[model samples]
Target: MKRLNILVTGGAGYLGSMISTKLIEIGHNVTVIDILEFNKTSLSHLFVKKGFKFIKADVRNKKLLKNLVKKKDIIIPLAALVGAPLCDKHPKKTKEINFDTIRYILSIIKPSQKMIYPNTNSGYGIGKKNNFCDEKSPLNPISLYGKTKVDAEKIILKHKNSVVFRLATVFGYSFRMRTDLLVNFLVNKAVVDGEIKLFEPHFRRNYIHVLDVANAFIFAIKNFSRMKGNIYNVGLSTANLTKLELAKLIKKYVSGTKIRIIKNRKDPDKRDYFVSNKKIEKLGFRPSVSIEDGIKELNYIYSNFNFKKNKNNY
Candidate 1:
């Protein structure tokens, strides 16, 4: 494969940190732009690489973004306010970064340049019972976070030169680890607190490892001709599980963890759906890490490491 010039926004973030490093390792010239909201040292190790370049700036800066867009062969937009709770806290900021920044990029980039975007499968809010959601499924986003991502996806599809991955709830460890994610949170609670409280435990959802998601970007870059103009649901097909089932799995790793199921209580974030990964799988993309492996990794991290000063939650 020939070396290509690629730009990644939010490169110091959890998923971005992994993606930036992988792109550099494969001999691509990568330029990363991030404001470093969480941890400043996430990309500290990549500073010495010849192909890696880091710029500390917000994606909403139109002048800086337009200049960067002109020189890249491929663009991966990973910058956004990720979860529902975080988006709720900053509604105005969410609209500007998640939706508006994307619109601005679409207007400036040439039709020849390729863009790979990551969207959440939570857009399939409250799916019909016993039914699986595919890429063709109707998107009914519940939260501000989901709505902005779904809206952004609609505009990206119209461009016909972009690839969108409707990703499942991502898990596992990265250079910038996130413990607030469902699987990671449960595992950490089990290890540290030895107990958990569940509301609406039977609501089902899908999952995928963070590394698998990073690899999907590389796969799309290599096969852009075949993947562009289409949206694929990226996830592990074996891991469609409910909150209760997930807690039980964590207990297997962390022995004697107590689980308290709270009935008649409501979960504020009511995203519940099972996703079908058949589309991406047919295209020859498979996720390597299993939920069991991810839980074990999180268990080790929480039990041994000192995250006293680390901001693991957003």
Candidate 2:
């Protein structure tokens, strides 16, 4: 593979930290720009690498972003207010970073430069009960987070050089470990509290490992010509289980953990849908880590590390 110059916005984030490291390992010259909203040390190891560079700047800074965008052959925009709750907390910042930043990037990048965007599968809000939502599935984003990503995706697709991956609920430990993610959160609850209260246990969703999500980006980079101008669902084919199923899986790993289902209550996150990875699977990209592996990984981290006292956001 030819060595390429890659720009990763929000490169210190949970997904960005992993993806940027992987890119540099493959001999790509990676320049990461992030405001370090979560943790500054996430990309500290990358600083010593010859081809890796880190710039502390907000993606919303148009002047700096334009200059940075012009130099990169491939751009991965991971900057965003990630979850529903976080987006709801700061709706204005969410719009500026999630949707507006993307719009700005599209306006400046040359047609020859490749852009691989990570969009959440939550946009497939309340998919048909028995059916799997594919790339062509109609997006009905319920939250501001999902709506912005979906809207960004619409414009991104218009650029023929762009490739979008509708990623499933991502799990697994990163340099910037996110305990808030579903599988990670449940596992943390089980390990720390020894109990989990489930609301909307029957609600179904898909999942993928953080490393696999990073690999999918690498896959798109290597096969950009073949995969460009398209949308692919990236996830683990064997792991589109329901909330209760996921909790039970965690219990299997974390022994003595009690699972309680609460009646007459609802989960604020109403994203319920099974996703199909057939589209990306056909392209020969397979996720290596299982949900079981992610659970075990998180269990090890939470059990040993006291994230509560740590200054870096876990």
Candidate 3:
């Protein structure tokens, strides 16, 4: 793989921060642009690295983006109004960041520049039994967040040198601990309070480690010729597990953890579907971290860092 100038939008977020660090470690010059609306400390560790550059700005700024994009060889767009509840809280802002930001970047990204987009499996909306959704699956998004992902995907897929990653629910620890994410929240609760509250425990979904998701971006960027203009579901087939199943896995590591099943309940950010990850696997891309392993790792990270008890105090 050629040494390249990689630009990561939302680089301060969980997936982006880890991915940027990996790229820097591999001797790539990485520029991270983030709005810092949610948290600033996620990028704190990268501030002093010579190969890493942090730009505190929104992706919606067209002029700023146009000026910065000239030096970039590849762009990974991860900036968005991330979750359903957050999108619901700020609908217009979500649409602008999630959709319009793509429009702005697409206008500036050189025709020769390559790019990778991190989409969500939640965009699969719902799936039929015995029919795991692959890239060919119809997207029937159930939330504003999912809808925005679908919209951005349509705009990006038209590009000749772009790779779209419909990623599964990401687990594992980062500088940022988002309690809203399924696995992380469960692990945090189980480890800290010794119990996890459940809603729609039967809802099924796939999981992937944050490091693996970051590695997939690196893989896609390195193998861009073979991966270009393709949509790959980024995860492991074995990582697909239900909420109850996930809780049980956490219980194995965290002792004396109690589980409460809430009947007739639903999550505000509801999404349930088993995704097939055959395409990326065909490209020799396989996830190395398992959910059980992620739980153990996250428990260790939380024990040392304790992001939950010190939530937002950073």
Candidate 4:
């Protein structure tokens, strides 16, 4: 295997921190560029590794991005306004960071440099009952965050020697934890808040662990020749469940948790769909962590750390 210089734009983030650390452990030189909008301590563990580097900067800086893009063998663009509510609140910043920065990178990236993009399954919006959305499924994004990512996905698809992974809702513990995610959010509330109320309990969605998502990027890098220029849905086939089912699972871990369903309430996110992982799994990439296991892990983390005063860590 060839050792490469990889640049991760949001290396301090929930997903990026894990990917960067794993790449360094496997002997690749990983450089992370992040603005530290959340917790800055997430990637600090990577400092001991000689192959790791961190730069505190925004991805929207074109001059800085051009200079960095020229030096990297692979670029993983992970920085973005991640959730729908946050993106809606800051639409202007979302457009610049998510869409415009991608265009800048595409124009300046070298032909030999590989680009691995992280897209959301939210792009699928809603799926038909009992059906799975594959990479070929038509995207009908209903939120600002999903729309921006869909536009960015078009850029990656048009580029040669590039790959995109439309990941399902990610769970499990991370150095930079995000309670905003579906599984993590609900589980945290059940444990800390002592109960959780559901608006659309029957809404379905697929899930994958954080480390599994990191492994998908690594798998794509190792098999770039076979997977480049294609999009794959990265999700756990067995873990697709409705929101109500998810709450019940959490109730098992958090004792005395009450789950109440609110009738006729709509999910603001509006993304409720089951995703297929057959395409990526056929390429020898399989998710390792189960939702049950992730729940246990989060239960332990929350037990060890108090999230009440540190809500900004997300």
Candidate 5:
């Protein structure tokens, strides 16, 4: 693999931190720009690495972003308000960061510079029976977060040297462990409290590990000419599962843990559906980590984690 200058925005977050780590490991010059919305503790692992540079900034800062984006090989835009509930709580900020930041970055970048934009399968909204969403599937986003992703995808697609990946719900441990994502949340509850809660237990969705998400970025970067101006759904085909089925997997990991179902507390997020990774698969991309392995890793971390002592760690 060639060592390229890789610029990752939101590189301090769950997936961003992991992706930055991977790039550095591969001998690339890695630059991470983040507002540290969750704080900078999660990114401490990168501080000591020689090839990695950290910028405590936001993408909306055009002066800073323009200067930083100069001569970069690939720019991955992953900073966002995240899920439906979070986006609903702060609609304006969500739109600004998720939609506006992307447009701003694209405006400043050179046409020769390649980019791998990360979108979400949640943009698929819903699905029909026996039907799975592929790259060509219609986008009908139901949440502010999903809508913002759609907006980003449109802007990136117009660029001749960009690839759009509509990602599935990411699981597994990153340098920063996030409990907000479904698989990690359930695994945490089951291991710590011996119980997990489910709402709309039968609603279906796809999943991928954080490590694989990072690999997809690398694969697209290396194969940029072939992948340019195309959209790929990046995830395992057989990894789609409902809330109930995922609970069972967690239970299998933490023996004797019970699952409790809660009804009517809130309606499900409209971003429910299965996705196909065929496009990226054709480009020789495959997920190496299984959900079972991810569950085991999360179980170990959560079991020994002390909230009081570690609250200030990350």
Candidate 6:
């Protein structure tokens, strides 16, 4: 094993914060550059750590990124307007941040520098009937968010020594909380509002814990040689569930959680598919968090923290 200098582009967001902390804890020198759109509290703990550095900047700032990308061994691009609704609200920013920023990095980064990119499972929009989607599955993304991620993955995959993880809906508690994600949103509603509303009850998708997502990146960083130039579906096989089914799970933890289904109501993110994570599993990485466990963690967060809950964060 070797110590490396790591750069995380969106190091203050949910998954970025988790992964950046993990890298620093494992003896890697980590530099995180974020615009702090949400705030800087998620990274407040890291500021005191020995091997961590934080920079407030945009990834699209070519003047800064040109010098920054050249200084690190690995680049983890986690800065993006994640989720369908947020991407919908800011389509131009989504394209620039999620897709074009990768294009810009590809141009400036040396071929020797390794990359790990988080592509979304939403790219498998309306997958093949009754079958689980794999790395070979055709990406027919319907939302601007999903489309941009798919495009970015293509560029990163073509880069030498780069890895891609087509991640599922990430859940679990984070310092920077997000209510727009399906599981997190439903659990928040169930706990605080006591009712969960579903527009499409039968719409199925995969989920992974925020920690597990960070673990996947750690696994790739440790095994970059074997994992490079390949795409893996990073999610729990047991956690492929629907909206109503997810509501019922939340009900178990938060009692008296009511569920309502609305007819003909369309989801902004329109993603419905199960993913097969066999490729990454074969490479010695498996997701350890289940949706049920994630629900328990959320229940604990809602019980302990005074979260300013809002339903329209996206």
Each model's lDDT comes to 0.90, 0.90, 0.84, 0.87, 0.83, 0.86
Candidate 4 off by > 4 Å: 125-131, 311-314
Model 5: per-residue Cα lDDT over 1-314, one tens digit each:
67889889999888899889888888899998998877458779778987789999877888898988996988888888887878888889899999998898888888998888888777574655554678778887777778888988998999899998888889987776678788887887888789998888877788999999999888887888898999999887878888889899889989999988898865445646777778788778889988889889889988887432322111
lDDT of 4 by residue, 22-104 (tens): 89989999988899888869988889999888889999888888888898999999999888888888999999999999998
Model 1 misplacement above 4 A: 125-129
Per-residue CA lDDT of model 2 for 1-314, tens digit only, reads: 78899999999999999999999899999999999988779999888898998999889999999999999999999999888888988899999999999999999999999999999888675656655699988778788888999999999999899999999999999998787888988998999999998888998899999999999999999888999999999999999899999999999999999999988897665768888889889989989998899999999999999777543222
TM per candidate comes to: 0.97, 0.96, 0.94, 0.96, 0.93, 0.95
lDDT of 3: 0.84
- Candidate RMSDs in Å, in order, are 1.3, 1.6, 2.1, 1.6, 2.4, 1.6
Candidate 2 yields a Cα-based lDDT of: 0.90
Q: After superposition on all CA atoms, how large is the RMSD of candidate 5?
A: 2.4
The better candidate by lDDT, 2 or 5, is 2
Question: Which TM-score value belongs to model 1?
Answer: 0.97
Deviation in Å, model 6, residue 180 alpha carbon: 1.2
Sort every candidate by lDDT, greatest first.
Answer: 2, 1, 4, 6, 3, 5
Residue 160 shift from truth in candidate 1, angstroms:
1.2
Clashing pairs in 5: none
Candidate 1 per-residue lDDT over residues 139-215, each given as its tens digit: 78888998999999999998889999999999988888788888888887888889977889988889999999999
Q: In angstroms, give how far residue 150 of model 6 lies from its true place.
A: 1.0
Instruction: Indicate whether candidate 1 or candidate 4 has the larger lDDT.
Output: 1
Decreasing TM-score order of the candidates: 1, 2, 4, 6, 3, 5
